[model samples]
Target: MITLDLIGIGSGNPDHVTAQAAKAMDRADLILVPLKGEDKADLAGLRYRIIESCVTNPATHVQGFDLPVRDPATPDYLARVSDWHDAIALAWEAAIRPHLRPEVPLKVALLVWGDPSLYDSSLRIAERLAKRLPLTLRVTPGITAIQALCAAHAIPLNGLGAPVTITTGRALRETGWPAGSDTVVILLDAGGAFGTLDPTGISIWWGAYVGMEEEILISGPLAEVASQILETRSSARAAHGWIMDIYLMRREPALP
Candidate 1:
């Protein structure tokens, strides 16, 4: 049997690795790190740095493997993602099989960027891998981008006794503002998804490379800061070759 631990390391900050996450990393026999190519080497480098700082057990093995890329040729969005997950599960198998033993329990770990359940597909890929291996999954939740974003801005997630909608940039672009909520938190924004909304009454708080040394924070009424955010986000992405950002939008007094 295999015990697969998915440990969340938080949003790019080594300090964000919780005590429990560190313990899970140290306890694992093997930790798999995904490599996204030289263009984003820093992303993989950060994971390696986390592993180096936390996993002190000389017996713990760290292996880096190339992550599978989703095929843009696939017509349907969901189908493309499903195929990608399947390929990733196969990648996991190839990386883990050599370490397996007959009728013996082994522990494997993977460091996740954020909480495995929050807009992440690691758990799904693990479950897909379980179809071929005798596997049990354990999750160690860490601080999410949403939490980090709010912390960076020193703002609450929602208004007093109010509901908040959490969504992706694609949905926000396709559907505009969601109903029944004054506050919305968006993740995985490709940049300027908020521009699709009518900025008349909304306020926005945005952050990029959050919790890291390169952190950038911006906030103001949507109309005022929208251009600044777009320009800043573009420049930041160009400078770093990669960017992870989130934003919170609220229509105070509610959008009628």
Candidate 2:
């Protein structure tokens, strides 16, 4: 039987890793890190640094494998994502099976970005692996970019008992702002999806690289800072080769 632990390492900051996640990493016989090509090499490097900093167990081995790319031509978003996840599961199996030995206990781990429960798909991929072999799965939670964003700004997630809607940039762009939500938190934005919404009566808090030293934050009325954010995001991505960001938009209540 193989024990698989999907540990959340939080954002790019090593300090965001939880004690439980660190312990799990130390306990694993093998830690698998996925390389997502040159554009995202820093992501894999961050995982390596976390392992180097936290894993004290000399017995644990670290391995890197190339992640599979999703098929862009599939047209259907859900189908494309599902197919990509299936490919990733196959890749995990191919990488993991070689390290397993007969008649010996094995514990393998994958360091995931943010908490697995959030928008991450590590848990789903692990489920696919579990179906193919005798595998026990465990997950250790870590801070999400949302938490880091809020922390960096020192702001409460929700305002005065109002409901907060968490969604993706695609949803925001496609559907516009959700009804009855005083605040909306967006993730996985390819670019400036906020431009789709009218900036009137809305306040936006935006951050790129929320927890790391290269973090940038901008906030105010959406109308004033929308263009500034687009410019900043473009420059930051150019400087860092990549950027991970999240933003929250709050719509003020109508005056009676």
Candidate 3:
């Protein structure tokens, strides 16, 4: 049987790696890291650094594999994503099978960013693998980008007795603010979706590279800092060649 541990390493910060995740890494016979190409090489490097810091077991082996890119020509969003995930699962199996020996039980670990239960698809991809292999899956939860964003801004996640909506940038842009939710946390925004809404009564707490050394934060009335955020985000993406950011917005008159 193959024991697959999906360990969440937190949002780009080594300090955020949980004790349980570290222990799993130390126990694993092999760890797989995905390289998302040159534009995001730092992401793979961070995973390697985390493994180096956490795994003291000399018997543990680390391997890297190239991740598959989603085909944009597929047109249907869900279909494209499904194809991409299947490809990823295939890549995982190809990278893992050569290293496994039938003589002994094997444990393989994949370090995931943030909690697997959140927007991450690692668990889904792992599920696909389980259908094809004798696999037992385990998860070790880590801090999410939402938690990091709130902690960095020193703010409560929601107003008293109020509902908070957690969603993607595309949803906010296409559907506008969700009904009955005064507080919204936006993630995976490839574009500044907040720009589509009127900034009049909204206050934004935004951060890029949230817990990393290159972290950038800008918070204020959306009307006041919206342009600044766009400029900053653009400049940072240009400098680093990639970026991951999240933000929280709350309308005024929040419960005291």
Candidate 4:
């Protein structure tokens, strides 16, 4: 039976790893780090940096595997994602089976970016493993991108006594800005999703690579900074070869 430790490593920052996550890493026999592509090699490196900084014991080992690419040719997005997760689970099994010991339960840790609960597929992949094998799963939560995004800008998450709606870029684009929302936090945005919304009276606070040393923060009226954001985001992505960003929008409410 595989003992899986799904450790949230936080937003690409070694310092953001919690004490519990550190201890979990120390106990793990193998830490499986996924490489998305050449563009995201830095992300894998960041995971390695976290292990270097946190795990002290010599017993733990870190390993890397190329992540299975999602098939973009599939017309159905949901089905495509399901297939991708299945492929990832297969890769996980392959990585684990070779290193397994019959006497000792395999302590396998996967360092996930951001919290595994929010906008992450690690849980779904783990569920697939559960169906096929008798395994024990443990989750250690870490700081999410939302928290890092707000912290980077030094802003409160929501208005006083108001609720905040968190949604993805696709949902935001499809719905065309949520109604009755004082504050809307958007995640996993590819680019230019904010341009789909009405920018006249709204304010935006945007952050890329939040909590990392190379963090970029931009904010102001949506009309004023939207183009600047697009340009800056593009330039940064070009320089770093990849980017992860999140932003919040607040619309003006009619006076009582």
* Candidate of highest lDDT: 3
What are the Cα lDDT values of the candidates? Answer: 0.94, 0.93, 0.95, 0.91
Q: What are the root-mean-square deviations of the candidates from the true structure over C-alphas? A: 1.1, 1.0, 1.6, 1.1
Q: Indicate the residue-level lDDT of 78 in model 3.
A: 90
Worst 10 residues of 3 by lDDT: 247-256
What stretches of model 3 exceed 4 Å from their correct place?
253-256
Clashing pairs in 4: none
Which parts of model 1 have CA positions greater than 4 angstroms off? none
- Residue-by-residue lDDT tens digits, candidate 1, 136-209: 99999989999999999999999999999999998999998888889999998888889888899899999999
User: Candidate 3 at residue 1, lDDT?
Assistant: 76
Model 1 residue 254 CA deviation in Å: 3.8
Candidate 1, residue 187: lDDT: 90
Specify the poorest-scoring 10-residue window by lDDT in model 1.
247-256
lDDT tens per residue, model 2, 127-236: 89888878999999989999999998889999998899999999998999988888999999998999999889999999999888899999999999999999999999
Model 4: per-residue Cα lDDT over 1-256, one tens digit each? 6889999989977889999999999999999999888888888888888898888989888889989999999989899999999999999988888887777788899998888999999999999988876789999998999999888888999998888999988888888787777899999888989999778889999999999999999999999999999999999999999899999999887689
Separately for all candidates shown, the number of backbone clashes (residues 3 or more apart, or on different chains) is 0, 0, 0, 0
Candidates ranked by lDDT: 3, 1, 2, 4
